[model samples]
Target: MPIELPFDDEEASTDVDLKTQIIRFILTGAGSAVLDFGLTMLLQYGVGVSGGIAKACGFVLGTTVAYLINRRWTFRAEPSTARFIAVVALYAVTFGVNVGLYSWLSHLWSETVIYSALAFVVAQGVATVINFVVQRAVIFKIR
Candidate 1:
């Protein structure tokens, strides 16, 4: 017996398969993470900014990058005000989740780079799941 995929030939040809979208999303996420982490570290260590503020700044910049790449490359969606609004709403929710979780977790651990990075990872992981699910199922769902 052979395993069957959800999409058929025509759909696979015309639409991006789930696997491809996921791969692209991961790649996009990696790039975004680099920017986010870099900025956070730079602000917190280099500029002497507070952890919470640095995290917020990093998250905003990274999220903006992720949204742009995910919209055009990952999901292959056209630009729309409605989609933009939906994304903004989604980001707002994730922003709180990501930053709040990081702040809380960072406080728990010693004020070291390793500990801070760990907190950031935990928060980013949670937010990434929420973002992928909502974006794939709702914001960029295929008609």
Candidate 2:
């Protein structure tokens, strides 16, 4: 299903302002983040997955959502096989960073729910910045 945001580019596919693109990207990321956090928590506490494993699973869902929304709404890029593969490669790199940091932080903290969530947040924040910069400048640049 397509999500129509304020800056959606159904008519135009290029010449978007940077600030506008950033706003749309953030909105897309926010929606993805909700899914990520919810799934992470559910898997961690409810399904008894380890914190790192839960976060890895959640990251996959979250980034996949982000890619769909960002391609259509934020960057307004037409789908391409090459672009998709590049994005998958980028996500693979970020996944390692996110999961590694999450695992390291989880080990430092007590196994309480709050600590787990906090660690996830920190790891997610780092990965978010990296994802945005790389996606905007390299993966989905105006072209």
| Candidate maximizing TM-score | 2
lDDT of 2 by residue, 60-104 (tens): 999988888888778787776777888989999999999999899
Off by over 4 Å in 2: 1-9
TM-score of each: 0.88, 0.89
Which candidate tops lDDT?
Answer: 1
Please state the error at residue 49 of candidate 1 in Å.
Answer: 0.7
Per-residue accuracy of model 1 over 35-142 as CA lDDT, tens digit each: 999999899889999999999999999999898878777877766678788999999999999999989998999878899899999999999999999999898863
Worst 10 residues of 1 by lDDT: 5-14
Error of 1 at 14 (Å): 8.2
